[model samples]
Target chain A: MPSAPSDSLRLRVDVPDRVAPGDPVPITFRVHNVTDRTLTLYLMGRDIAFDVVVERTDGATVWRRLEGEVVQAILRLESLTPGEALVLEATWDQQSGAGSPVAPGEYRVRAELLTEGDPLLSPAAPLRIAPR
Target chain B: MKSMALSVRLLTAATVLVLAACQDAPQPLAPEVSAASVGADRASDALREVMALDRTVFGGQDAAGQLVIGVENAGVASGVRNVMERFGIAPSGYRIEITEPIHFATETLRTVHRPTRGGIQIHFSNYLCTLGFNVDHAGGRSFITNSHCTAQQGSIDGVAYYQPTSSTDPNPIAHEADDPAYFKGGECSRGKVCRYSDAARALYQTGIDSNAEIAKTTKGVNSGDLAVNGAFEVTSQDNSSTTFSGTVNKVGRTTGWTAGNVTDSCVTVNVSGSNIQLLCQTLVENASTQIVGSGDSGSPVFTTDGTNANLIGILWGGNSSGTLFVFSPFKAIQDELGTLNALTDGTGTGGSDGGGDGGGDCTPRGNSGNCH
Candidate 1:
């Protein structure tokens, strides 16, 4: 079903503020239904509907969760009642899509829900990868 | 006097021997550095040098959480030599591999009821979806639909299924029986929830009439309504391997009967805007036509041999353009829900009543004989 509005759903991304080089970074994403009625949402198939992207301070994309992965061509319908939320978690071994480690520096991580119409984007959460 | 002199000499000799033993005693060894500590130190220094060399350089740890780094393949030799010479590190001191650079890319049914077979409107709390097919579960008649069609997923008796687009019906035709809970870890991708099928079963009330058939359209493959032109009896199911491919058909509430080619089999799909992911799902494509749409979430997918239909899966969702659709194979449903005795050979408890054409009286037709 087509979405009602972008405001009816909220997306949030969470990660540690700082981590030592070579440390595994745990990421958490939450999609909450903020509407009073149940909302049927079209989500990408595969286990990932949203993406957690890590970018350098200058806005160069360093790593993304959905990049380079083969996701099926199916849209899924998920209904969320009012006040319900889904928590998605992934641990980044600090490796980029190329299987290389991200350089230690100031970076930001954000999440995006691939919804119909405009995708809902969360604010960039600051992340600093410092040398241990 | 001679005896005293001999005793003093003996005592002096014993004292001399004791002094010699004390002088020969081993001293504590100096503190030594372990090979592991030295290697670790070198690895740390190498990591610092590598990160300083290029900001775009990706560095991280392996599954063992040990510090490791990846440099461009073309520069691996020089990079290794630079770190070794600069940090006095050996090749075994740290882990490294050739890695390419990462580039960012643009990311990319209805109801029904019963004596009621499949392809009819089914309702639950302000929503409409198609009933996929009817089955016999534990000696009782039941119907299947998408888990999202119910008020709650993964809960037994969580929602009631009704017919003809009404939740205010005096009695519900069926109550939810089983919709397996989504799981994480193991085979599921990191951070995503997964389920083998987007299917749920609803047990029919004691007197509700149903058959093991799906609605067929006489209008055309792509045209029809809630009206039933005929019925497709399910004779068997597709149990092929993960690469199974074929042209499949389905009848849903919004879009009646439509056919498409199986383009993908047993692929992991991420449901957009949700954390749930369906694993090993079938994808069908009809580039020339839109086969499924909203309110058609639970349509039964099958293939017919002119006389009987072979069950394949249940339509859950598709691409927004409707060109691509996905279904959960019956094999997956059975694997999760155990045995679901779907009526084949045209045998059912209430007997076939040819089913109604949306405009007919759908009152419980109790054993009123076969309507085939």
Candidate 2:
């Protein structure tokens, strides 16, 4: 994923409001270029610029998609035309960062576009992990 | 951190405008011309002189989207014409107005719970600012921020500091502890209050948790109560005025985390409003867009080596055009506070904690707590 000036871009995070225990939670991050002209963005290469983090209700982070993964050091420029939307998808297996099964509870999921400037952030979407 | 004495003297725009505006001339439409479009050779020279007078003076635009040069008073209004005439610039091409002095006075994606650290938003009275770094002060917990953000800029008035924003009033997390007074005369020129840095330290209330680690990205939602993802560790510092040329990252509340290059180091900035002048300030140009905004003062400035960071300074002011900003280095900050060190990763051991100053005579702590 590529990152640009946050004010010129809009980010949205989509997650299921409720999911049964042990079910794979699919998270979608969509970035739209709302400006009138094409914008050049900084790419961290290899989808490393995008991250999905799930946190407990107390604001404690439980799982982050990029945790412990070595991100490539390469940075390149990519262009996104106006009105175009970029989407990235990831699945959280309901596991904590330490590889333990996450407890059935309420959590919030958010996405980030890590750029050289302030990272463009998406509102945290609420999700409930309950045993059906 | 190496220390260097700054000797550059800069004249304030108010003084120059007063000198140029003494005479009256033909009235011209509020100088509405762009300096960039002011012709080729001669206009460029005039633009250079205008910039040399003061970078902050002629770089902003007014509401109508026209380039505006701010003057100190209506009398100084004619000074704009005088400058245009002296430099052979056409008065028909530019706009000028009698405007008040630019001020660095103003958010929150920086709210956090207990165990606060650097780069988070802090509120006092009706203003907001960023916490520069958590430090070990007098065997207690303290944080660094801009003096202007305090109840008073030149004196410690025991002002209470709230986290996130002013909505959490009456429940202050810290109180003003150390802030050096601004002096006039001697090293400072006449008619101005001078200070080595616009920095002040606040002692955290008892039981208020904190760490030396600065915030970065990885976890958090929008601008509301951002979850901690503190990864920055201050391994070293640059307190010298030898003109730095490298990438520095600023984790400010308004602009979250932004990177830029040091455009000017150890330059003197004459903050116009109250005749206050800051000495040995570092100026940065944002890499892409506007980075600094209101309420971002005291934001942590540092250089990172992938995982670890070298603490640089605290942001204080930006020009009307937010592309450029100014900060005071750690040397000036320490010159006022005396032998301080950044407490990183909750470890009290100076320098070894990877976020503290090693050579200070102050006693280091032992594991302050979880920075994240």
Candidate 3:
């Protein structure tokens, strides 16, 4: 008989209460493995290549994946075993690469957790940033 | 008949000449009427000058006779003896009547009314509430008073008030680069930035003790008596101490210098006004020390010991109990003023505990134990 799959792959993200333009918005996520099996996960988002987010709270969803070249060597997290947790952090610069500056407003951040070979999106939590 | 007529004409001519001589010789001025009129005129003039003095000189009309006069610019008190000499009043000839230093009773009344150059009405609230005199220290940058009396942040003509607090390292905060020009004798305080009108300056000048000459003559002030260096005078001695025990003889700008007694010694008074709160301790057994009400925060406390009186404390604040009061020691005040270099000698050194000039030399008048 094959062993039962673990349902413990949980994800969490944290954001600041308020942010102003040109200010970095730091986003951190923690993934925990509840089962005895190993897990692999990847974090993807638009223009989200830095250790922190410095974007305006404009109502745009231009999600961009962060790359090693853009985030330097500071953007990597290895795999984790059962009963273990993997932490990944990134900074989103609002003024990076001369994109349209984000306007001041409330913003919601979405963090999706996935398992290797699995296409299902894990639980998502919403983080709100008040206008500065 | 012709000879007699000539003689009569000569007599008449002689009479006319005598009358002319009398008129030209300045007829001996009538002694009583002229003397009375001159005295009345002099008295009138003195009264007018006194009236013209700033009403705040000693807290208003209550201090009419108590306001000391000096020869300096105006508000400065030359010396007790010198003041007496100016009025032809002799300290030796008359008995000394030491009274409690004048203090205003409330902060609301301490506010001064003045007109600015711009024809704008500027209300000086914080500084006005804490105006009073004491020997200064602080390289002329600081003076001594109840720490609570000093504002955490004060302003004069929109300039930030500067003071040294334990929280600020290197102490004695300075104004910003764009701050307004510094005001000198026109207005001053240890705790807050006080403003003065032209009349206020004249009032201060009338009572200033710049040379410390009066300090030399002061006697019988105790270790913790409140002292000020501004306009004040000692008038007639009221033999009836019991009748006026708790009543203030002099009046000033705030509550009219009414009399009160040290209700408690070493009492603590907690004061809250203008969004500021502070606790101050009056002298030991100072229940009779004229615990300050509101505007009286900066009034000086003195005692009559010998031929002259001496300063003891600077009105600061009170404790929660309201029974206890607080004041700054004259010596400490002098040290602060000295730090400001405001003293004439530019010496930031603190004065002797004995009223800064051998004053406060009297034994406690009554057997009141620790009047707190």
Best by DockQ: 1
What would you estimate as the lDDT of candidate 1? 0.66
- Computed on C-alpha atoms, the DockQ of candidate 2 is 0.01
- Candidate 1, residue A110: the lDDT equals 96
Per-candidate DockQ versus the true complex? 0.03, 0.01, 0.01
Interface RMSD of 3: 31.6
**Residue B131 in candidate 2, Cα distance off native in Å:** 0.7
Candidates sorted by lDDT, best first: 1, 2, 3
As for TM-score, the candidate ahead, 1 or 3, is 1
TM score of chain A per candidate: 0.88, 0.91, 0.55
| CA error at residue B80 for candidate 3, angstroms | 39
Per-model TM values vs. the true structure? 0.49, 0.46, 0.25
Q: What would the per-residue lDDT of candidate 2 be over residues B1-372, giving only the tens digit for each residue?
A: 111433222233333433245455455334456556666565656545554553234534445444456554655455555666897767665555444554321122455445677888787754567888888765356788987777756665778888865564457788877666667556665566677777888877777777767777543312223334545776676655435677777777666676778888877776522456677777778645665755567888888875677887888766433466778888888777766678443432222111222122111111121111
- Tens digit per residue, CA lDDT, model 1, B180-295: 66676567776566777878777676778777788776566866344456688887866554445778899887667898899988898866545567789988889998787666
Q: How many backbone clashes does candidate 1 have?
A: 31
Candidate 1 segments whose C-alpha is farther than 4 A from its true place: A1-132, B1-114, B224-226, B239-241, B344-372
How big is the positional error of residue A87 in model 1, measured in Å on the Cα after superposition? Answer: 21
Q: Which residues of candidate 2, in runs, are more than 4 Å off? A: A1-132, B1-108, B166-170, B219-228, B239-242, B345-372
